[model samples]
Target: MEVIISNYPEELTFPQEYIDNVKAAAEKVGELYDVANGEVSVTLTNNEYIHTLNKQYRGIDRPTDVLSFALNESEEPEIEGEPEVDVLGDLVISVERAEEQAADFGHSVRREMAFLTVHGMLHLLGYDHMEEADRIEMEEEQRYVMEQLGISRDDAKEKKAPKAEPQQPEADKKAKHKSGFIAVIGRPNVGKSTLVNTLIGQKIAIMSDKPQTTRNRIMCVLTEPDAQIVFLDTPGIHKPKHKLGEYMVKAAEGTLKEVDAILFVVDATQKLGPGEMYILERLQATKRPVILVVNKIDLIEREKALPIIAHYTSKYSFAGVVPISAREKMNLDGLLDEVKSYLPEGPQYYPEDMITDQPERLIVAELVREKALHLTRDEIPHAIAVDVDEMTTRPNDDVYIRATIYVERDSQKGIIIGAKGSMLREIGALARTDIQNLLGSRVFLDLWVKVRKDWRDRDGILRNFGFGDER
Candidate 1:
């Protein structure tokens, strides 16, 4: 089998080993199907571009890690002349989605990419999972091909084992260490980010009082002497007002499948509404432990918080209920203890020094947006998004960064710019301080406000701004 690979979004870089893995998986698929020879194409891209394709072809309108366009299927137009060789369809894989899934599944991205490639190849050979028998057959074939290629789930686990440093004592190695992922989810303005930051003991996820302040699923690592918890701070779930909101809801819901535990955060002061009820209904379907966290207890009396906890407890069988103030960092230790008790014994997923899995560029962009959310009023915060266009460091000078702040309307643009560009300057200055602290260097930030009219509703514009399906 001949596998042709192309990297889309030109900016992404993949190692030679990744390309080799895909080729090997494709060849294994061909061998399994007894094909004399075949051809396949793999395109590597980000979530936004693949999400567009998924919506266009599959009509699901969400970003998936891998999509198969099989030529053997009737979806392809036929030509009159016979072909000299069999041509399998094209496979489009999202590198970003692969990374996210790899981390969630506790494996290497190479393994994830290889698995996706084999799955796509099987699909190209007319394998599907629409029915039980077909699903079993396809899964069996996928496992057989992956095992032949030395890329089974166990292989991935072995590949992901952490390397020992200067070495710990035998006693330390014998000690049981727990590790697992916990997802923090709730409706908008429920203090989810604040709770995650409190648990991680760092400012990894950007925070603001504005609704939907967090647009992406931010992962933060908390490594302790006995346990390591990877906390996924997802965007607050809300009703879909635009394409972005729909993506956020999907991103939050997607975490339910991959996490070992779920933290259902809710504002203690607010009455139990449809949003919390909606989340409760979803949580009922998952077998994993769900911990009901009634946040903002500092604002409400103990008497008030009791009913809130009782209300949620009556609805579902939560593993535990803890009322605390994420802002005040109250009773967080209890919450952490509860979380740790549920985690099974496992190896550390990330290095201790690492605070978050997000790239520096994404952190900088979020910082910029955090400032915008705090400074703007009304609907401006929801209409705004920041993209880091450039970030470079000089040999003997400050690091320079150019970022664009996108809004949905001309009037909102004027609000962001302010009179004589005062608001823009303020946003830049505030954002620069955080950027400088984050990079540990002096920084120069250039702020530009551009109007991308109703970008939250347009798929193409959302992709350009980096608000892919992952967000």
Candidate 2:
């Protein structure tokens, strides 16, 4: 069956790995059932738009969980023109709702969304939970698929302990010594999050071999002996050309003023030039001790690394010069040791158990952005912005998400839509996979696209897209 999955109103915000899981689940289920071909349309959307859809299609007065529109009434979807691809009708999900449900379910937004995508896909395959037996079967399949994708409901899945001695006797509970900030900074695509993951010893910050995938400052904490290090994983620094660019740069610069120490990450394999120099200029102004972290040493020779390090050292009087690979987890301890030495004494900023300070909904929106950044190529990154319009969870334990994908122009919209909606279908297919991963259970993601006429330049559009206003 030709499964035509599309995100409504906008592209989804999630990771690539999550998207892969959705595709794998589809192939596996289709193969097991001996279904030769099937076509399902999955769209990502926001609350207002999905509310419109719910009102128009289902005659429901309010936005509900996932709404399934089944074209095959009697049996499984039949292969229409070609017996190889069966048309399985359409499934619309609200990303905004999926994010809300994820928070309610106490899981990563990616997990919650993946669950939703799987649930919707099953509906397209004629799997319904209206009956108790069918509901159990569907739920079991969801869990089975999640297991295959290496996703866990356990909290330990994303956590790390600081290397420190056992707790010492303390006179006061709040007087315990522990608190510092490790600000991660770099030009866009320098593997800052990879370094954070290495330090945290877990996948807290989603990593991909893509540039500008991280849009916000994600703080992951590590409590060491007499100190709790808050690792601030900032967005990749780059020239500001759009509203998002300006905001991302502001987020990066803001950390410089607040943090105790800074980890200036650089792609070791690439030549150090203007971008590196521009960042260096910013570091020179910061009073905090700067640790020059030359990442991706795995891609270079020992001899080559020395010269690169030498060249950078000559350019700036960095507090410390360290060479290591973030992805390979090399020389991380030494880097952490340097960071510890620079930390100022203070109480723990967050409880020892807390890893991040970002809200679940914001992360969910970021996850959708991550998915879109990877799926769309070239200048599409600048053209795309995801807005969580409506999110709600039902008493029966299902999530509803609605998201909007905003583009700058009508031509760009056409580019996103693709030939006879094939491109849009591809975007949905890619986004649904991750949405399912984030939501964990059944999620209804409704996606849509709208042209705002150079939103990057318009103040109102920027404000609506969560920019133009001081945070």
Clashing pairs for model 1 are none
Predictions in order: lDDT: 0.82, 0.69
TM-score of 1: 0.64
Clashes in predicted model 2: 76
The lDDT, on a scale of 0 to 1, for candidate 1 is 0.82
Candidate 2 has a TM-score of: 0.59
Poorest stretch of ten by lDDT in candidate 2: 155-164
Tens digits of per-residue lDDT, candidate 2, 1-471, equal: 444555555454544544554465555555555564665666666667778886665444555445567675456654568445555666676766665544444455566556666666677677755433565687777677667656665423212122233554665323234368788999888899888878876455766567766767787888654677988899888888877778888888888888888889998899998998989888888888888999999998888998998899999998999998877888988887788788776533442334566544555566566666566667475667778788777776566777777788888787777788776667666665665555554566676777877877777877776665463
- The sequence of per-residue lDDT tens digits that candidate 1 reaches over residues 1-471 is 888899998887776777887888888888878764888889989889998997676444567778888775555565878665677879998877777655555567778888889878887888876443575687788778878878755455423323333655876543466899999999999999988888777677888888888887888889776789989899998888889988888888898898999999999889989998888888878999999888999998777777778887888999998888999989988999999989998855553445686778889999998988888856475988888999998986578999999888899999999999999999999999888877777899999999898889999987887667753
Residue 138 accuracy (lDDT) in model 1: 77
lDDT of 1 at 137: 86
Off by over 4 Å in 2: 1-176, 201-211, 224-226, 419-426, 429-440, 469-471
